[model samples]
Target: MSRETIVLDHLGGHEAAARLIGGRLEDVLIDGAAPRVGTIYRAIADRPVKGQGGMFLRTPDGPAFLRQVRGLAPGQALLVQVTGQAEPGKALPVTQKLLFKSRYAIVTPGAPGLNISRAIRDDDRRDVLMQIARSEMDGGDLGLILRSSCAEGDDDAIAEDIRAMVDLAAAVVADAAGDAEVLTQGDGPHQMAWREWTAPADVITEAGGFEAEGVLDQIALLGVAHVPLSGGASMYVEPTRALIAVDVNTGGDTSPAAGHKANIAAARELPRQLRLRGLGGQITLDLAPMAKKDRRQFEDALRAAFRQDTGETALVGWTPLGHYELQRKRDRAPLEVPQ
Candidate 1:
């Protein structure tokens, strides 16, 4: 497979967008924006509301909520990391735990031990990386997950990356404990895409005056009514308040075989569509109506296609009405939402 590409589009003002490989809009970030997911902040606990269970915390980005307020009181300072952004009418979600990510590993403070990425399926290789983590961590509480990229680097480079992450985490903790209101700024999507991808990506910007790039135009497709597929079929994709819904239409084909082929094509496109649009949470697919046996066959094909996704996905089986249920964990907001 070819390595993914990253496109950095800087719209006028503070706004910017990062499109990952496959023309998928990954994330949009802004300068001086509200605390985003993975952002760390210094939070001062406030008095609990009369009936509210979680206490409000005064953070640099704004107020956040600590759901389990045990042992925390007003005027107490705490280090918190942003778990999720503030949704419409919802406050930002934060946690006391913290994590640091580098090219090779993810370092988690206040967590125990080390884990190897499941992508490193070779048992012998897993054992070697595990031993390296154990030896380098040296009984520290910082946890490490050797990312798949670790396989590309030798022990010395991996150890250096881990040590750098550990040091960065320690510095963040110290900063959060100090008088500074802001602990550390989170990485923008452009920087993050570069770090996460296996190969380097060319960064483009509107500021560069590149008129031929259709990336900005493609952003509008996130809200497109339907996407045409081969075999005269199309997939209807829309995001509801609850979840994303996809409907497969055998546009011009009526034969049983045609419908089956369209279903297979839709299944193949679903993963790319989801990633491209950055749509997550629960996704329900309304496949073309078919017999029980055909539906089973379609389900198997869909499951096989979904396996290609890196995100955690669950095939929740098909409904009697021919609706196929599945869910993908939300890493970021849908592309339709402004960053």
Candidate 2:
């Protein structure tokens, strides 16, 4: 019953997508101009690492990391998909496993065969959709993964989506005529979010728009020294070159029960804050001093909230210093550098 909205801000030479839940910025996607992830390019395989399973690919966007596979060879022309944006001095990540995404599903050239969405609880409906996917694929080498949206669609609709994806893949392969070229342009952040969450309430681009202004203000708040949580507590979020650290403070609530309550409150909002800021990689949460029972309760709240995130986030265990460790896959560059 949560009301969600998507806002696209294209101002000051930046394009970003902010997803708001109950008028709060829950998740944001930043769209960059060039060399974005999801773009497909034709590249030449560079030298391969002997022991390591990675190789360099000479692409139009620059050299990228390619996972060494059986068919990949040095100096050979290969088609690759950008997996992640390049960091300050690092190269972009690319993979040979080409994939085309549709509204209902994603088509892959890899060996994943067919996978129905786990969100669909009805076994009979899932089996029916799987059969439809298989029939549409027709024993081809292409693989298909029905997205969560597929649960709302019928078999015929799913089949049509698969066909469209397959056709689009064929068109992209045909367009890859040169040694190094961009075959398919990647979707902007707004488009990507729309596909993931379905059409939003409204998409505003004007600089002075109300929703746009609100999202911008929220982003600015994300840069402040401390983030306000319930129970009058605050969190100090700091991102380092190696990892991100968050320290929870009770703001003068010195009682043990108060500290434990503050930590639990912060735990509930930490995941949403992390996604809003697009802070990925290793994260260390410095919890308030609490008993073992309180720690377990705090962790439970943290995991439950993080489960709503689209990213593959994992709770890595607590540190010797009572800090909880978390790891999230790096999908793109940080939306804003920590101040």
Candidate 3:
């Protein structure tokens, strides 16, 4: 039986949360200096970039870049939410299509409708959730989506979540006419852990929980690129200014299928490695010398592994030089160790 645990603690003076599956660290979330994703800002439209369809907006934190600026004019005030973290010296990424997300529900302001998660295939359960949504929404102009977490959730709790999100959306929309300012701050690490990590797990909230739960030791390994795989195979994940490079090696494995085995192992482990280190953007994988016939199997394993990942990733297939490429969203900030 596998035991899962969640440790809430402080790291380098920042709030942090770690998820451990069967005593192995699986995921980590730490508060970052950059504005968190989901932060709502009433911003003033600034100058538009030539040739690019993006426009700059002035916010309380800094300048934010928003795409899909079709009829947006300069000096017009609009509500935008932080979509992702920006690179150093780059404008913050914001989107006009704001979504208010919670554990059980997501309220979309501009889009108006009520929908349940496709994962909830049970007709009875879907009907129950839809009835709850309809009752709370009351044909409002905003949209409501019941998340997968609500499939087996309690009725009253789900109703409260829906109501809270709907109220928040209405209030924020009403505040859209204000000057450039922050209307709502995003959830911190602890709050996010409670909101998203709904899986059954042992919770640790006391001080020094990270050290007690061995999360600190696991986090230390993130600073190094070496990741060991079964049968003496290994992979090195190195991040560069342009892309993240993953190099797979079959160490001391002299079998005929050594390359294939090592590549498969690397595929299974890549998503967890990237998630823990909070690394994203372009990723290029240099696998071992495997035969062309094995590419399909490797891709299948990679796809299956990433299916459980929360980050948005696009596998761009193999390059002419035999390297595989992927583009990942920068949803989480890069892990920074305290000096």
What candidate 1 gets wrong by more than 4 Å, as runs, is 1-4, 12-34, 46-56, 66-76, 122-135, 154-156, 175-180, 199-214, 312-314, 336-339
Give one digit per residue, the lDDT tens place, for model 3 in 1-339.
339999999999899999999999999999978999989999999999988998999999999999878999999999999988898899999998889999999999989999998989999999889889888997757999899999889999999998899899999999878689999998899989988898888999999999998999889988899999999999999999999999999999988899999999999999999999999999999999999999999999999999999889999999999999999999899998554
TM-score of each: 0.79, 0.88, 0.98
Candidate 3 global lDDT? 0.93
Residue 85 error, candidate 2, Å: 2.7
Local lDDT at 26 for model 3 = 91
lDDT of 1 by residue, 172-247 (tens): 7666555428767777765665556555455665464212455555656655858888999999988888888998
Q: So what's the TM-score on candidate 3?
A: 0.98
Candidate 3, residue 34: lDDT: 90
For model 1, how big is the CA root-mean-square deviation? 4.1
Top of the candidates by TM-score: 3
- Name model 2 segments beyond 4 Å from true: 68-71, 154-157, 173-178, 199-213, 337-339
lDDT of 2 at 181: 80
Whole-structure CA lDDT of model 1: 0.72
Note the residue pairs that clash in candidate 1: none
